[model samples]
Target: MAGHSKWANIQHRKGRQDEKRGKVWTRIIREITVAARQGGADVTANPRLRLAIDKAKAANMPADRIKYNVDKASGNLEGVNYEEIRYEGYGIGGAAIIVDTMTDNRVRTVAEVRHAFSKYGGNLGTEGSVAFQFKHCGQLVFAPGTSEDKVMEVALESGAEDVVSDDDGAIEVITSPTDFEAVKNALEAAGLVADMAEVTMRAENTIAIAGEDALRMQKLLDVIEDLDDVQNVYHNAELAE
Candidate 1:
């Protein structure tokens, strides 16, 4: 598995704990609000909203809460206006990092992000600073017991770029953003259930950071992700097991 995949696995494990604390529901609600605001309240017609709703449902977010947030986003109720932003930076040991956020105030969000990086021995960079070092790809993960060869065959047939089997017993499929839904549907039709699916920024190359640098990188990621405005953190830090 790649660093991104490793980080995702870590998050999944931590997410259960987050759920108990109600943090997962907050994040899911933010995503739902943003998605509905951007693409309207119709889940069937709004792909982004559809995905967010699916995630919310999977997380066991209450149906009434989901509807409330969707209504808030669609102007049926009052809510904060959010703008999506991406921050590119470098973490300890020069590992490239990308932070995705949805905030009502861009100035406050950027300052908070910059402060976290600088405090953690990292530096915030200009736009496109480290983006070129990564590839924006669609990822769909399948759990263990799914036939790898069968899954790979369907993914490739549905325009996926690659299928990689990991030691964690999960299979990760890569595809272009436009082909993601099709590829996912194909796999599902073949009796494969996707554990997680998202369009993510994947590092084309990664840096192996050990000891102090690795610890610093994790702290930086935690700081960024703990921000209420931040949604996702992508980095090239090769987290050791």
Candidate 2:
């Protein structure tokens, strides 16, 4: 990840979200429903639900729409039941990938996922195949030129685990999943707003792939992400912007 700033990676993800803006609401609603159903509707008692709501707000989802989905999933109203699934695989150049999905039909979901992998220059692997290469945690990445000292001070005071400044000038604050909200709030209060903040499966290491290989790998990822049941896509490949 040397030449690529952490903020660059965040922008890549944001760019992908923008490209699929039409489906953003659909994805957020599914996430809200699933999080609520699994952990109950009380945001205070349910960290997962709270995170889902945070994403909804970031996507500009309406307050009433968010609450309706939460209540519906909590059984206060009617909603579709979803089951979470994780698919691991190798992309072009053996880049590791993990796809997180929530679906009512595992049959259709798996078929579509497997088909997408096969359609591209990749192969879906067994459970835990690429998962071992990732760590589930909360990550807050600041844009290049942000004040590293201030970010470090506020993040540490707010329960962040580590703060690192990339050679390229992006600052990253890592925290345990449960402590993410507090750290993010503290940093924002301190005027150190992050470019990206989320509970994510971050790659412990990276694989750099460029040229045609990079293009193919990105296509594989985009296809997997476009699936209706897919919630998130994580990969170790750092492609050129």
Candidate 3:
């Protein structure tokens, strides 16, 4: 869990840098559109939509853009009918990788993803090939000032599975999928604003890769994440300390 936390912190910091370049807004828009399409446009009623909106707000995305995307998705305003897709594979040093994407064309996304793997010294695998090594959990990250004990108490009372440390100035609360919204709301009510919250696939075990392999693994992640269709990239590469 400490390793997971550390990696999350790194990603969070990287995300802040990416935000300055406007890439984060693009990613958030895609995520919000998908969430709206799947769960309706009402943030109060759609938990996933609410999470997406929160992310947009955190990234300083314009309210008009957020509303426009939600409306476009829920109103089906004649655009790409984006679909959620997951790609499983191995990274440098045999570290398992899982990439989440939103694309209108599966064929193109698959080719692009596979090319990334191959070019980075790895190969793509079938649907369930590497997913079995991971577990799906709802993770909620708290702001730096949030009290750990208070957050933990709220999480536990709301049926959270675990609360752990993160390398970022935050804490992560893991909850069952069904309990995600409830737990998030509980923590928020207790004055803990979540830095990031999402249901993600987490690797059950990680493989330590060092030196050149570590650099290759990071490069593979960067390539995958740079893909326009990619939403999230998960892997079992033990993050270098």
The Cα local distance difference test for each model comes to 0.83, 0.88, 0.82
Best by the TM-score measure: 2
Model 2 bad stretches (over 4 Å) = 1-4
Candidate 1 lDDT trough over 10 residues, lowest sum: 1-10
What is the descending lDDT order? 2, 1, 3
Per-model TM values vs. the true structure: 0.89, 0.95, 0.87
Tens-digit lDDT string for candidate 1 (19-64): 5446667777889988998889998889889888887888788899
How many residue pairs clash (N, CA or C atoms closer than 3 angstroms) in each of the candidate models, in the order given?
0, 0, 0
Q: List residue ranges in candidate 3 displaced over 4 A.
A: 1-21, 142-147, 165-170
| Stretches of model 1 off by over 4 angstroms after superposition | 1-21, 143-145, 166-169
TM-score, cand. 1 vs. native: 0.89
| Pairs with backbone N, CA or C atoms under 3 Å apart (clashes), candidate 1 | none
Better by lDDT, candidate 3 or 2:
2
